[model samples]
Target chain A: MFLETVLLAQRELRRNVLRSSLTVLGIVIGVAAVITLVTIGNGATQQVAEQIGSLGSNMLQLRPGQGFRGPGGASSDSKRFTLEDAQAISNDIPGLAAVAPTANASTQAIYGNENWSTSITGSTNDFLKVRNWDLDSGREFGDGELQSGRAVCIIGATVKKELFGGQEPIGQSIRLKKIAFQVVGVLKSKGQASFGNDQDDFVLIPIRTLHRRIAGNADVGGIMVSVRDADAIDEAKSAIERLMRERRRIAYGGQDDFNVGDMREIMSTVTGTTKILTALLAAVAAVSLVVGGIGIMNIMLVSVTERTREIGIRLAIGALGREVMMQFLVEAVVLSGFGGIVGIALGLGAAAAGSVVLKVPFVLEPGIVVLAFGFSSVVGIVFGFFPARKAARLDPIEALRHE
Target chain B: MNETPVSSNNNGAAANGAAANGALIRLQAVTKVYGTGIAAVEALKGIDLRIGQGEFVAIMGPSGSGKSTCMNILGCLDVPTAGTYFFQGRNVGRLTQDQRALLRREHLGFVFQGFNLLGRTSALENAELPLIYRGLPVKKRRVLAREALASVGLSGWETHTPAELSGGQQQRVAIARAIVTHPKVLLADEPTGNLDSERSREVMELLTALNRDRGITILMVTHEPDMAKYAARQVHFMDGLIDGRSTEGGA
Candidate 1:
């Protein structure tokens, strides 16, 4: 019986190959869209998470004068954090990994005959440790460089690639703001961070060099603090808050005039936003599957009306009503199964193409492929049921009489 | 499933004397009325029939004389409004649709006026259809279908579809399909109605041979007296009633 039905389906399918192919095509596009969108979204989110994780997970940034106002009820300047505050935090905070007070200024760096414009960041050696950065060559600024406020500099991979022409850039002097600074080291490439900024585009110098020689300002931008353990972030945050409030002489019940930005909190926010966006995009793609299912329903209805006489003949020949129903149901399932196969191929192709275009890794999840195929079949069964039942319920005598 | 028990040829239950003559079919006062109230048309008005085993019977009537309706009841294609139809000692009127289908597929084979062969099907496949419904293996069905087609003088024409065959040959294929299941009775309604005279005679000869030589009971409906001559018995119906009955001279 199964063989006869298979032969019947094959014969019928062969009779109208063009029509069957067209039906399968509808399902292909739907599955392909779902796979491509999901893969690209997944790849992007993975990239962001990796970048965020590579950064200092236990690090927190302390900005002075919260909400653009001072504790004295006066409008505060954005650059309210000072070198003195940085020193106070370093001295007061226990279980501290490292503290770096950073101030940045965009300036031009020049060698003997080469010149390049880049952002010059002034900070102590602790800046590299707190930011989870490592040097590829030479050494960091030592006590000698810091005591004399020597104009020594560390360049990033991009600056290395540009000025050094792929050569080893260690121990090479580059002038910043027309001041000559010895090249201490080249930092390893960190790629692009979650904030879309190139982590390797800046040159680092000592804080004294920037405040005394370049910017001539004692004010600091922000103090980055690396805690000893990531699990102690909450305790460290409250301690830092209390210390800063005391240092600034804030009354009890008064909000601290500063913001503590934890990397963990930022990571949660970033991932949460990405998950919502992925859902939104995936939901939009699912609508197309519904459209594809409706297409199956429409075609199956047409097939039923066209094959009324054939149905009558089978019924007269002792085929039970359920048998007739199963044949059509199986045909619908076969159609969707064919569509699923083609859709999987299309989806893989789309994902491959997307990886090249988006410049991100291509991830083909086995679970998603299985899900799309299963969903397509369910769509076929759910939508194909009505037409099959309608055909089964048809009276054989009436059907035989239909022209 | 051939569940209807075949009555023993030696049984002497003659309490219902009409059933004693070894009639394979007994229709007692069968009536089929279409619609209800004043708009109703009585297709068969209390039809009583008894056809014996191995008998080639023809029911002759003009159009609208309840002949086709009687055929429908005999074919088990429709149920009677109110009557008792004993097919091989079992009450067919009380049987379910599946039972009727099983009885038709196992005990009775049909040939229609239009030679209702599936258009795209080969002669062999058409012949094998009944066995397919019977759940026979493919190889066995193929072998049986080939034998049935060969019996109808259609050897080596198994692969030819109906459209490719001549009218006589198409009817032969239909006949092959009917006899493939080795049914107890063959029911044909104007089996040669759509054929030329030469083809019609050929179809009639095949039916006559099956009835006489194979001992298969045959019931045929026709209006032509010439067609009725091939049967062993004739039943003339008129105005929704049997007008007369006669036996054909031995061939």
Candidate 2:
């Protein structure tokens, strides 16, 4: 019976080759579009996760605020933490590995008739250890230079490539705001971080040097801390906050005038948000599959109406209603199965092209492929049933009377 | 007929002077009425019939006679509105639709006026359709179909579709399809209606050969007296009732 149904369906498909092919094309494009969009979304998410993991997983950032807030907000105006507060945290906290006072300002650097606009960060020698940035050449400023506020600087690789252009920049002297600073070191490349800013695109100078020669402000921007391990980060956070509250002479139960951020916590929150957005996008694309199923239903119904006499002949020749139903149902499933295979191929191709264009890794999961195929088959069965039932229930005598 | 299988079970009854004829089909007080109330039509009125085994019968009638209604009831394509029909040993009015279909497929063969071979199907495929419905294996069905077509002198034309065949050959293929299952009764309603006189005689000759030589029962409906003359017995119908009957080939 199954073999006979297959043969009959094949004949029916051959009889209306153009229409059947068009129906299959509709389902293929729908399935392929869904898969491609989902694949690209997943690839973008994976790229973000990788960037977060590559940044020092053990680092925490402390900015002066009530809690975490974006750049534009009403509470943006607040007293910045000073270098003394950073030193007090470094000295008092037991689980802390290193702490650095950091500040940044966009400035014009002059180097032998080659002056360029660049960003410069001022911090202590521990900044390299806290941020997990490596030194490409030379050495950090000595304690004598930092204490006396000598204008020695460490240039980032981007700044090095821009100002010196393939030339060794360790001993080169560059002037910032009319003060000459010798480049004592260069930092290694750290690519772009999750915030879309290049970590290796700024120069570093001594904190005291930045205070006296550059910004001439005693209030530092923030403090960056590195923990011994991930497990001790939360304990280290509370310890530093307690010490800062006591040193700043705040009354008991007063809110601390700073925010402590764990890199892992921020990453998890960002990943969660992006995942929700990706699912929402995928759901929107899924609507196309339902519409494609409806198209199949419409076409199949038309086929039933057209082939009334054929159905009558089969019913008269001892074929049961179940057999008639099976024939049309099998036809629908075959069309959808063919579409599913083509869609998978198209989706994989689109994903590969997207990865190349976006400069991200192509990530294809086998489960998603299985899911798409399963969905196509289900759509076929669900939509094919109405027409099949219509065919099965037709009366043989009346159908034979149809012109 | 020399091909008739001998059954001696009723030998004592025959010796007791009982007639040897056995009813292969029986219809009692059958009537068919279509539609409701004022627009109603009585297509068959109180029809009673008994056709014995190995009888070649012809029904002659005009268009509005009850002959077509009797043909429909005999073919099990429809049931009488109020009657008891005993086909073989079973009561047909009590059977389910699928059961009726099975009986038709197994015990009855139909040849329609239009030479109703499925369009686009090859001659051999058309012959094999009934056997396919019977669930015969593919190789056996092919062999049986080839033999049936060869018997009807369409051996080499197995691959030709209906459109490619002459009218006589297409009706011959229809006959092949009808007889492939070796049904107990062949019911042909104006089997040659669409053919020329020569082709019509050729189709009539094949039906007569199957009836006379092979000892298979045949019930045919036709308008031409010459076509009715080929049957051993004839019944004419008028005004939704059987009006006359006659037996031919007597001394």
Candidate 3:
């Protein structure tokens, strides 16, 4: 009986092919929009997480301020950390893998006639270890250079490309603000960080050289620390915080002047924002599903009215009320089901194209596809019930008599 | 009014005798009103009727004379306002709408003036509709529909839709649909009204054959006297009442 009703519904839909197609158009658009929006949103979130993750593994940054309030805060009296403080933390902390006290200044570097404005970072060889960076060529600062405060520096990949052009820069001299420094090594390309900063646009020099020849201060801007084990990050952070408080001579219950930020916390903040945006866009897209359902209901009602005589004939031929209802309901389901299939295909294609344009990972969520399809079928049923009931409740005599 | 029995052939005679005293359809003081109070129109007014099993009866009247209302009540398509109706000894007046539909589904067949086959549907599927409602398997229903179509001389026209066939062929398809379920009674309302003279004769002949050979009781409503001549007995309605009856040339 069910199969026969389905056949009947197919015939009815086939009879009015144009009208049926138009009716299902709304559902197709709604499902496709929902799936495509969600897919792109998921891809964006994944991209954000991956970009943040590439900054460093199990690393933390301690800055001379409370939280992320920039360098100036109410604790203006707080003292900045120096190379000695970095040495103390490295010696005192058990799980410490590398501790580098870094200070940066924006200056122009001159290589013969080519001069480019770039930031210069002053740190020891441990800076590369803490930042998870590597050199593509050349060697790190030798013990002689670090101890004697020699004018020696390593250029990043971007700096190498800008200053050297196609020429070799090893053992070559570059002038930074009237001070000449020998290029000891070149760093590998690290690409852009999550915050959209170019990591390879800086030159690294020894802390002693940067303090004595440039900034003329022993103050370190921040401390970058890498934990020996991934699971020991929290312990390392606590140990470092306690040591800093004790060395700074902070009274008990007094707030520490320094702030320690984990890489994972920054990653979560970025990913969380993307997730919220994705959900908001997806919710807006879901409203169209309801609109599509309303379209189905409207068209079904018109169909029932138009086929009054046909319904009358079925009833007179001894079809039960529910049977007639089933036929119409089945027609509705078939329409929405077809729309769902077409929508899924279109959504997948659009999402793939969108991912390419947006430069994000193409993520296919099978669960959402199934959910959208199932929800469309449910929409058919919910919207179809009213028209089917009206058709079922029609009086055979009056319906037959209808011209 | 005379209650003479009319038999068209020897087979019809024996079948008619068996059903002569058994009323397959009985109505007592049946009244159907269309609306409420002053705006109401009584379509059927205190109608009393009796039709025996295997009997071929024709109901004839002009527009608004209640012939169609009487046919509707007999077919269980509408309920009477103030009367009891019995079909095969069961009180149909007390039956719910769904129960009435079930009774029609199991034991009755109907033909309409419009040759009301579903548009865009083939003849065989139209014929198979009642059996489909009966929940018969597709194979069995198809076989029965083929036999019914062949019986109506439409064996090779099974795949033709109503719009693709001539008026005569469409009426034949409607007849095939009516008899496919082997119903005990067939109710036809102006079945030949839309056909020409020749096509009308063909449809009437088909209805007569089913009544004579299969012993299926037939009740038809029509306005044309020529169409009424095919039935063994004739009942006349005037102003929502059964005015007279004639059973001339009957068994």
Candidate 4:
């Protein structure tokens, strides 16, 4: 009996195929929009977390700024950090793992016939430790090279590619600002950063060598601090803040001239914003689903009134009230279930396209797909009951009399 | 059944045997009121009726004379406001709505004046509607539906929609639908009211042949004296009461 009712429902739907399709259109669009938006959002969130994690772990950046870095960075006129500050942080902080003071200068490097313009940063061997960078080959700056101020440098992947092609760069000399620096090491490829900039496009040299020959000054722009463990970060941050305030000569209760920003804090801020945005998009999609359900209810009510005589015939032929109700209910669920399937296909296609266009990963979570489909069927049940009950409760005699 | 299954030329003898046996249906002092209080209008006032197995009885009355209401009660589509109705010696008034529907599905069939065949459905499908409610499997349902349509002289019109068939053909499809379940009783209301004289006579002849050939009990409500004459007996209803009876029906 149930099998026959389902067949009857399918035939009824097929009889007015155009109207049936139109009625389910809302469900299709609603499900599609929700799936597409959520997929792209999840992909973006994942990309953000991965990129942030790649930068460093349990580290903080201390710069010459009153607060977090803005578009132009901190107040430009503020006094810069000296290498002594990096030494002081390492010596004074108990849980410190490494401290690296960096000063940067943009210059053209020449080797053979190829010359590429790139930023040359000066730092100690601890720079790699603080930034979580690994050497692809050769060695970083040794104590002898730093103490003697020798022109020994480590070339990044992009600089090596631009200046040396396939040639080996170790023991090779590259001239920066007329000073010849021997490449003692090569940094591994880190690919592009989240901001679309090449991460491997710079060269690193000993701080003393950079100050004595290339940069001709001992001014450090920033200091990177790495804590020993995640649990030590808060203590390290507070101790460093107190020490820096005292060293920088800031009065009590007055804002300092430098900024100490925790990488985790920045990560949390970005993650929170994206999570809220994703949830908001999902809420909007759910609202549209409800609207879709209302659309189904409206059409079903109209159908009950229109098929009065047909309902009358079924009733007179000994159909019980529940049978009539089941017929209409099954029709509604079948309609929405079909719409959900179509919507899933369309949504995945749209999300794949959007992923390509936005450069985010293509993410398909099975939970959301199942949820969307289940919710659509539930919409049919919730919205279908009223019209089905109305059809079931119709008087056989009066319905037969209906034109 | 008390009557003969094969076609019997001796209709009087068969009806006589039924009169001496248990009745297939019995209505005792049944009354039906449409509304309550001051607006109440009585449709059946303490009316009593009995029909035996294999009997063909025509109920004749003018409009608003409660003949339709009496037919609805006998068809199990409605219940009396006061008094009792029995089908196959079982009290119908004590049954619930779903139970009544079961009784209708298993023991009774109905044919409407409008020919109430579902529109846009094939004749075979319409004839098979009752079997679906009866939960019969597809193979048997199709065979029985084909046989019912053949019995109604619509064997070639199984796939035709009601709108595709003429009025007489549609009525035949309705009849096929009514008898598809081999119901114990067939209640037809104005079976030929929409047909002309020739078509009406043809329908009457078909009903008479079904009664004599299959020994199926038939209760029909009609206003036309010509149509009523086809039945073995006729009962006249006037103002919610049985005013007269004619021919061989009474026990």
Candidate 5:
């Protein structure tokens, strides 16, 4: 019985191919818009998480201010962390893997006829360990270099590409702010950061060398720390916070001047924003689905009226009321189901193209596809019920008599 | 007119035979009123009717004479407002709408003056519609529909749609559909009203052949005396009441 009804529905739809296609057009556009927006949004979220993950494994950054507003913008009353503070934290804090105090100054690096403007970072060997950075060639500064504050520097891949072109940069001399320094190593490439800054566009030198030649001060801008075990991150954060508070001589009930930011927190904030945007887009797209449903209802009502004689014939030929209703309902569902399939295909194609343009991963979520298709069918039923019932309740005598 | 009153014999053997070939449709004091109070029209006013099994009866009346209303009630398409209707010994007035539909589906077939075949559908599918409602499998439905179409002399026109066929051929397809289920009673409302003289004769001849060959009971409503001549009996209606009836031959 159900199969017969379905065939009847198919025949009826086939009889009016143009009208059926036009009726389903709204549903197609609605489903496609929802799927495309959600797919692109999810891809962006995944890309953000991946970029933040690439920064470091189980790392935290401590700035000498209440927040990361900018360089040299710390609270005037707050004291900057010195190299001693970094060493103290490394020795005193348990579960600590590495701690590096970093200070940066933007300067022009000159080598022969080539010169490039880039940020110059100064830190100990532990900076590379905390950042999970590795050298492409050459070696780190020796202990003597650190102790005597030798004029030795390590250039990042961007600096090397800019200053030396294709030439070997190792054992070469580069001048930073008029002070010549030997390039002892070249850091490996680390692509763009999550915030769109080039991670490989800087030069690294010993902190003492930077203080003497560049900044002429012993103030460290920030501290980068890595925990040995992922499970002990919270413990290490509290331990370092307590030590810094005591060393800086903060009284009881006083807020600490420095702020520690976890990489996980940054990752969550970015991903959360993307998720909210996705939900909002989906909600707006859902309104289109409702509009599509209304379109279906309007067309179905028209169909019932137009086919009154046909419905009457079926009813007189012994079709039960529910049978007539089922035929129309099946027609509606088939229309929306076809629309959903075409919409999914179009949406996925658009999403893939968008992913390439946006430089994000292509994430295909199967659950959304099923949900979209199912929801479209439900829309047909919800909107189609009234017309079906109206058709079913039609008086066979009057319907047959209809002109 | 050869008129014979209903026999009153109470013999057990005769009663069994009479019951076996008894009235397939019986209406007593059936009244159908349209609207209410001053606005109401009595479409049927206390009609009493009996159509025996295997009898071809023509209901003849002018417009608004309630012949169509009688046909509607007999076909289970409408229920009487105040009366008891019995079909094959079952009280039809008390049956629910679905039950009446089931009775129509199983034991009755209808032919409309408009042909009422679904447009754009092939003659074969139109013929198979009743069987589809009967829940016959596709293979069996196709076979039965093919046979019914052949029986109506439309053997080569199975795939032709109503628009593609002539009026006579379309009426043949309608007849094929009406008899596809081998219904016990076929109710045809103005079966030949739309056709010209030649096509009307053809459709009447086809209905007559179906009755003679299949012993299928037929109740047809027509105002044309020529169309009424095809039936074995004629029941005349005037103002919603059966004014008179005539039998063509002695039983």
Candidate 6:
């Protein structure tokens, strides 16, 4: 009985194919909007986590600040660390991986006719280990070069491309400001960071060279430390904190003037913000589904009135009220279900294109797809009931008499 | 689903019912009033009527003369306001709405003035509607519908929609639908009202043949004297009451 009624309903809907398609357009757009926003948002969050993961999850950055507030903040007035602090943290801390005392200056890099403005960081080979970078070609600075503060540098992939073009960069000379620095090695590309800054756009020189030749100061800008593993990070951070406090001559219970920021903390904060934005976008998209349901209800009421004579004929032929109700209800469900399928296809396609443009992963969440599809079908039932009941409750005599 | 016992082919009970008063249906002092207070309009006022098995009765009257209301009560589409209606010795007013629907589907069929064949539907599917409501399998419903169409001389028009057929042909398809269920009684309300004289004659011939050949009782409401001439009996109504000049042909 149910199957027969459904077949009849299908034929009835097909009779007015244009109106039926128009009626379901609302559902299609609503579902498509929801699916696309959620998918793109999820992809963005995933890309953020993956990009931050590439920066080494167990690494920590120690800067001279109570808390980060824009650029420099209190760190400009507070005392910066020196080379001894990096050496002390390395020797005193157990289960420590590597530490690099680093400072940076923006300079115009010139190799022959090509010149590009880029930042130059000064540190030891330990900087590569702490920052999780690898050399693509050429060797690191020799110990003698580091001890004598030789004007030698390692160029990143982007810097190498900018200064040397297609030419071999290793053992080549590049001028930074007035000083000539020879490129000892080229680092492999690490792509973009979470915030879209190019990780492979800087040149690395020895710390002493930067302190003497560029800044003319013995103070280090910051310390980059990589813990041995996740389990030892808390212990290593406390140890480094105690040593820095003692060396800096801070009294007991005094508020420390430095902040230790872990990559993990930054990763969670970024992912959390993106997740909230994604949910907000999805919620706004959901409002359209309710509007779509209203469209369904309006169309259904019109349909019941248009088919009044047909309903009369069925009732006169001995169709129970429930059977007539089921017929209209089935038509509503089928229309919305078809809209759901079309919406899913359109949304997934749009999400794929968006991912490429936004440089994020195309994350296809199966649960979300099912949820949107199911919600559309439910919208049909929720909105379709009133019209179906109206159709069923019509008086056969009056309906038949309707002109 | 309400399942009502079908008494269409129950020969023993039907014989007993016929023996009771030589009638298959008995309506005693039936009355129908529409609305209430100053707006109350009595459609059927103290009407008594009886129809024997296998009898073709034509109910004739002017508009607003209660003929349609009488037909509605007989078809179980409605109930009388003040009296009882008996079909095969069972009180029709006592049956619930679903049971009346079951009785309609199982033992009675309906034909309407506008040839209420569904638009965009093939003739065979229109004929198969009641069978579908009865939960008949597709294969069985198809075979039965084919036979009914053949009996109505529409074997080759099975796939034609109503819009594709002439007025006479559409009425024939409606008849095919009515008989596809093997209904013991067929209620037709001005089945030929929308047809030309030629088409009307063809439809009357179809109804007469179904009555004589299938031994099915038929109750038709029409004001056309030409159409009324085809029935075995004619009951005239006026001013919410029967005029008591009913004529009977040889049994």
For every model in order, the fraction of real contacts preserved is 0.21, 0.26, 0.81, 0.57, 0.81, 0.55
Off by over 4 Å in 2: A1-4, A66-79, A107-120, A137-186, A190-196, A208-216, A234-259, B1-22, B64-69, B115-119, B212-216, B223-226, B245-251
By DockQ thresholds, what CAPRI class is model 5? medium
lDDT of 3 by residue, A201-307 (tens): 88999988898999999888888898989899999999999999998888999988988888787777777888898888878877888888888899999999989
Superposed on all Cα atoms, the candidates' RMSDs to the truth, in angstroms, are 5.4, 5.2, 5.1, 7.0, 4.5, 4.4
Given candidate 1, what's the lDDT at residue B84?
Answer: 71
Measured with C-alpha atoms, the lDDT of residue A193 in candidate 5 is 67
Model 1 chain A: lowest-lDDT 10 consecutive positions: A67-76
Q: For residues B95-205, what per-residue lDDT tens digits would candidate 3 score against the true structure?
A: 988899999988899988888888888999999988988889989999999999999999999999888999999989999999998999999999998999999999999
TM-score for each model: 0.82, 0.85, 0.90, 0.79, 0.89, 0.90
| Candidate 1 structure quality by residue, lDDT tens digits, A332-380 | 7778877887888898898889888887678778998899999999988
Please say which candidate is ahead in lDDT: 1 or 4. Answer: 4
Off by over 4 Å in 4: A57-82, A88-98, A102-192, A195-222, A225-269, B1-21, B245-251
Off-target runs (Cα >4 Å) in candidate 3 are A1-4, A67-79, A107-117, A144-151, A172-181, A208-218, B1-21, B245-251
Supply the global lDDT for candidate 3.
Answer: 0.86
- DockQ for all candidate structures vs. native: 0.35, 0.37, 0.69, 0.51, 0.69, 0.58
Lowest summed lDDT over 10 consecutive residues: which window, candidate 6 chain A? A68-77
Residue pairs in steric clash, candidate 6?
Answer: none
lDDT of each: 0.81, 0.81, 0.86, 0.87, 0.87, 0.87
lDDT of 4: 0.87
Q: What value does the lDDT take at residue A70 in candidate 5?
A: 35
lDDT of 6 by residue, A274-367 (tens): 9999999989988888898888899999999988998888888888999889888988888888788888898899999999998889999999
lDDT of 2 by residue, B163-227 (tens): 99999999999889889999888988888788889998999999999987777789999998888
Residue B93, candidate 6: how far off, in angstroms? 3.3
* Clash-forming residue pairs, model 3: B5-B250, B5-B251, B6-B250, B6-B251, B7-B250, B7-B251
